[model samples]
Target: MLPSDPAAVELVTCGKIEIEGRLVDASNATLFCGISAEGVDAKCVYKPVSGERALWDFPDGTLAGREVASYLLSEAAGLHLVPPTVYRDGPFGPGMVQLWVDTKDGDDLVDVVAPRDVPAGWRRVLRAMDRFGDPAVLTHSDHPDVCLLAALDIVLNNADRKGGHVLHGTDGRVYGVDHGICLHAEPKLRTVLWGWVGERLPDEAVEALRTLRTAVRGPLGSALAEHLTRAELRALQRRLTDLLADPVFPTPSADWRAIPWPAF
Candidate 1:
């Protein structure tokens, strides 16, 4: 059984989605949907059930809770991230739901434009970076302006980052989805955003960080105090400190050194 928190939102099983027969996905849990949530809709992801043993051996409720937390934190930091649907026990156990994006087609910047070609979509991505300008805008990567959030994700130990994780909507804006791995306290940062290292954090991004840092010390921090432990909250403050101290390419700590080995 997964850990129970009265705060967790109870999600009823809306229905079941069968993927390849061996595995079944439950989409009725909430507003979120996985890639296989519908036949031929690629925007969804296969959200793992709360107690099901599968790819990652993380504790139950860990993924769902962190996704929610990551969304809230990213919002506070002024970064784009996937928000998860709150889930509690249903017929099958605790489960979180999320909207899916079709990663196979339009969302992929890789196939449409070659690395040599930073197409309009990717150019806009770069532009969004300039617009947000919040150095505290952590993702997963660590190389300054490159994959700023990606570096942040690496620090937070985010798993499940695929080419499709980033989506370019018809509105011409880029949105990130899937933040199941975060707030680990330990260093688990991993991502693929080292393309532009050594650049300065956008001015606006810095201001956003400053705002969040201050907020965390006040009402916002007090509100979160209920959701997170003192240690986890301190780690967040420390991350902000690290970013401010070295806004240009902040590196992970030595004790938490060593990237995960190649998938071979």
Candidate 2:
């Protein structure tokens, strides 16, 4: 089981580590696997600020903090989609560290996106071309976990929600990761999980948002204040209020691209 207290997880992440290797698939950011000395003995992902590539849109050295912020929001909102993450000084300077999730089958959303035949019970959102110009059908499960992820992405203003970031755990839970580009002050939400666009928000999701609305004014807000700029915090609050008021899935914005490049 994952550690329940955020402080405990932070301690584990900040302790000494033995670098396992680098994860090359993490484009624009360097990711490392390491074994911690905090006694958890679990493998963790270490993303150092110095290794992050400068992006024209996002400020440099802030991606690591954004990763931690996403975890904080997920915890406060009771979404439990993002894995536990902490920001601390690592071997390579300050960075974010998170426990690596052990997926059940190593399966990702990419599998369902272009299956030979559509999976039974899955909802197809749209028909599109894959990166190779081949035909593909974008889809997602009608499961509650998927819905919660969609709602969380909206609040986060996630600019990248690629299919590879979605994971299925052995515990029968769904997880979303790679949140370094989220929570921008600007309206930069981009995602592939739009299967429920324009649909009414589920009761569970609305209640979660209500809980988040309260947490943001209390402990959650204070914690995030250290990581995000004031303007970004205000934007998050505005998004929460808007979500609570309307409680409907949003459609793609005409002004901005709605999906990330190489959708998977």
The residue pairs in collision within model 2 are none
How does residue 128 of candidate 2 score in lDDT? 73
* Candidate 1 segments exceeding 4 Å error: 1-49, 52-60, 84-91, 101-104, 110-148, 151-160, 222-228, 251-264
Best by lDDT: 2
Q: Candidate 1, which ten residues in sequence have the lowest lDDT sum?
A: 1-10
Model 2 misplaced stretches (Cα beyond 4 Å):
1-11, 110-116, 130-134
Each candidate's TM vs. the true structure?
0.59, 0.91
User: What tens digits encode model 2's per-residue C-alpha lDDT throughout 1-264?
Assistant: 453435547654666766788888787546566555546566678888989989998988899899999999998887788888888877788888887777766455544456566677776767877779878888767777888898999999999998888877766778888999999999998888888889999998899899999999998899998889999999999999999999999999999988887677
Best by TM-score: 2
